[model samples]
Target: MLIVEELHMLLLRPDGRVESAVSGNRLYGEVAAVLVDLALHGRISFSHEKHPTVDIVLTEPTGNPILDTTLQRLVPMRGKRLQSLVVSPKLDPLEVVVESLVVQGVLVRGERGFFGWGSERTPESDPAPELVLRSRLAAVLAGTGAPTQADLSLLSILQNLNAARAILRAECGDISARDLKKRIEQLTAGSPAGDAVAKAVNDAIAAAMVAIMTPVIVAATIT
Candidate 1:
């Protein structure tokens, strides 16, 4: 399963509904994961061509049509900042990722009608994936042992959502929030990527997501 899917499932409840709207954080964070995964798999490479710009360039066809298409889109963005490339209107990576989950069995489709006129087919995560994923994350957060690469990736997504508190409280022992925060710090500090570019890209994406979410957060607070 993709790390991003696991994160989505975690935010999903047993009743087949997401706890929050499809926020910018979740949307862009998943896109960032796909980009980073492709980079780690050697399908792409990231470099700074000029000041304050990290460009993603495809190295080879990844064989996955969606990823390959995204790679093609990146080719023209040779020297653009990663943030700009992420928000490019030409692509909606979140739709691609969520559709993949729906195409798989992890999420199921249902219909909903609003205002008595409009209906939409929405998908929500299956409980099974979230159950297993949450258990695994809970164990790791409790310091049961060292985390695997997948675990590290999961940490990145959940962290970006600022869902650590909910995750720790719901999935694990009666640990303090501080402890949960510390454990996440420990895990990310030891993220097994071993590639500086991947780490930098991940950090940049997380930062960008934070910026994207901040306005939404404030508007919600004010309302």
Candidate 2:
């Protein structure tokens, strides 16, 4: 599964509702995840600066629908700061991601409430993928093994969402939430990938945070 897909899976409960704690930031996280996946696949690259800008290295389709769609969108936005892409309402991919997952039989769509006053729900049709992903993250976070570049990317996004503690606390054995948070920070800071890869992932994450927080800060100040 693509990292963004895995992230969507992670952000969901078995009931298919997005985890309440991270719902507000889910769109930003998914956007960042897609960008990071693109960078890791060599379809894109990031500039190193105070606020990083993304450049498309290859326009070839990635075959994955989500990545391909996002790539097409980025074609015209080359060299734009990552924050711009993340914050743009046009870039949110939740519906596409959900549709893809539904088609893959990873999630099953249903409805709640009576009559027509209901909301849609997408409970899991296949739970194995998410279970395996959770185990992998737990192993890495528990210091049992090293993390791949993908793992680092996912960790960086989760940390930015302040979500690692909520998602992995149970699977990480007896580790305190405080310690788990610290482990995520340590791993994200010192990714196991080579320097260039580490820098790209870290910079993308930083830009994502700026994009996510800018509106909240503005709204708070205005009020």
Candidate 3:
């Protein structure tokens, strides 16, 4: 599964509703994940400046419709700040991810409420994928295993979304929220001696966090 799909799964309830804590910014989280996935695939890269901009390294199709479509949209957006991509009215990463999951039979699209007055719901049709994903993340968070670059990227996006605690609470067992936060920080903190790929992933994730959080911070200050 793509990191973005895993993120969407984590954000959802068994009944298909988005977790309350992340409902407001779920799209942004998914968008960030998509960008991180692209970076991991070597299809994109981020600048090292204060406000990092995204640049497409390759325009070749990724075989995945969602990524391919997003890549096409990003063609004109090269050198744009991550914030722009995250908030772009034209880009609907969440919708694309959801559709992909539905087609993969991971999620079932249904409706709820009175005749025609209801809203659509996407309940889980298959729990196996998410189950495996959570298990890997649990092992990493529990310090029982090492985290891969994808793990760090997903965790970083969840942290910035302020949904990590709620999403991982059950899997984390008795681990305190403070400790979980610390562990995530330690894992995401790139090693100066790490390989170039790891460094690039870390940079992409960090740039994504700044892009995802800057507007919220600015709005809070203004209020």
Task: Evaluate all candidate structures by whole-model CA lDDT and list the values in order.
Answer: 0.62, 0.79, 0.78
- Candidate 2 all-Cα RMSD: 2.8
Per-residue lDDT of candidate 1, residues 1-223 (tens digit):
6554565566555545455543334556556666666666666666644223545554578776557766777677666776665556554454555566778767766665565454334455555776677778777887776676667766655665566676446764776767766777777787656446445555666667667768989999999
Candidate numbers sorted by lDDT from highest down: 2, 3, 1
TM-score of each: 0.75, 0.86, 0.84
Q: Is candidate 1 or candidate 3 better by TM-score?
A: 3
Greater lDDT among 1 and 2 belongs to 2
Task: Kindly report which residue pairs in candidate 3 clash with one another.
Answer: none
Cα lDDT of model 3 overall?
0.78
* Collision count for each candidate, in order: 0, 0, 0
Candidate 1, TM-score vs. the true structure? 0.75
Residue 86 error, candidate 2, Å? 1.9
Report the Cα lDDT for residue 34, model 1.
Answer: 64
Candidate 2, residues 134-188, lDDT tens digits: the string is 8888888878977877787777677767787776666767877677778777887
